[model samples]
Target: MRPSSALVLAFAASTLAQDQIPLVDKVKGWFAQATAAVTSAVPAAASSPVASGRAKVAETIQHPLTLENWKETLTVDPSASTPTTQEWLVYITGGNATCFGFCGNATKAWNASLPFLAAKPNAPKFAVIDCDAEPLLCNSWSVGPPSLYYFQIPKPLADQSAPAATVRYQPLNRTSTTVDTFKKLVLDNDFEKVEPYEGYFHPFNGELQQYGLALPLAYVMWGFSKMPSWLPMILISFMSRTFM
Candidate 1:
């Protein structure tokens, strides 16, 4: 039989072990990002329909987590999860080249790139975040000059603290950049830190939507709030333990 992927990776790891690879260091970039996302989104969570927004918010955001400090701490059960590694790349324009924050144009650009991604059957899913005015600039969304931020939306819950990749990049053209070009630039960086490799199965997707979380079907749980937190926790714990 062919060598197991783990065995092959183990050999690679052993061979490269002496290289002093700063895996998580390269990926920990999202630490600040995690803090920002958590802090900024807290408001939205607070105003959520739930009372203990802190708990629900923490838990849900916890579910769709990011990888900002993966090496320092990795607690998610990796064996049970399918791997969908992720990334987030941001390019800025306008305002003296100083990046204020998320950009809408980049978001649009990413939207344009998705159809093309249909070809990468095994690649992590993708999404774009407009950084023109969120973490770096204003606290709210606004229209601004084009900038690009690419992400690998890993299989939803790929990691406990779901940090995506910001593919390593340098300036490439001013007006337009293609997704393929972006992918080509970042995937093979020797210096790029990237050791936080964990995996998980994504439960929420189109199929689930059609069956459960779908509109009318989801409404069936409209009164779900009435359910005891203990019950849900018990279920989630059981479900999580069952798979992991």
Candidate 2:
């Protein structure tokens, strides 16, 4: 074969080997990548938005629910003759802290939505329960603060002794944590029925997209450069026989 043809064949063989021949190298690369991924993931998992948001919410709320009025505020009497179809639109706030001593995002959303939400044919009662002040009450239900829970009473009745059964409004990873979303949650009366909002790009894909094609092509070129000259000839010959 001509020098140019031989070089071309050799390059082609090297490219094939770079992808398949170095088994040990491939394994080591995989293991290293997996280890790095796990190591890098630890901190991110620990400090997720939900985790940090809850902490921040806790810090903001200075005045929480007190034991004195807790029972009276959350009570629902279903056994009475004129029993009302009661539902509690409770905001399990981190604290009494609003963004500017008024109301936070969730609170503001509720404030704007209140007119519409209350106008519903059979609207539920609305109240905010400070998790910071009522940790025991909040913890009993395994709730993370700065969340919303809907309570259907009357039928459930007020069992001051035990915690109320509530439906958590856990929208798609906090996407549906808005007042409009909560209003929908209340109107639908089922959190599960609500579809997760996909308005934003997926976080995993966003990170990958930021990398682009340069990094992958660079790795492929690096692998090709590291290939042994003879390795390509062997691969090419093997391919020729396998095909013929």
- Choose the strongest candidate by TM-score: 2
User: Candidate 1 regions off by >4 Å?
Assistant: 1-109, 137-167, 170-172, 179-244
Q: Tens digits of per-residue lDDT for model 1 on 1-244?
A: 3344444443344334322324453244335456566788456543334434433432332222122232222232345365645443333343211222222233334434444443344433332222222222211111123543233444336345454432322333433555554455444332144432222211122343335333343232322323543454455556557555
* TM-score of predicted structure 2: 0.40
RMSD (CA, Å), candidate 2 to true, equals 20.6
- lDDT of candidate model 1 versus the reference: 0.35
Residue 206 C-alpha lDDT in model 1: 34
Question: Each candidate's TM vs. the true structure?
Answer: 0.27, 0.40
Worst 10 residues of 2 by lDDT: 197-206
Query: What is candidate 1's TM-score against the reference?
Result: 0.27
lDDT of 2 by residue, 1-244 (tens): 7665665675685576445425664465456556766777566445466545654553343223443454465556545443344566666654321111122456445545555666788666666666555544443343444566555444332443333333434412222356567666777666656453222121112232245543344344445544665666676767667655
User: Cα RMSD (Å) per model?
Assistant: 20.5, 20.6
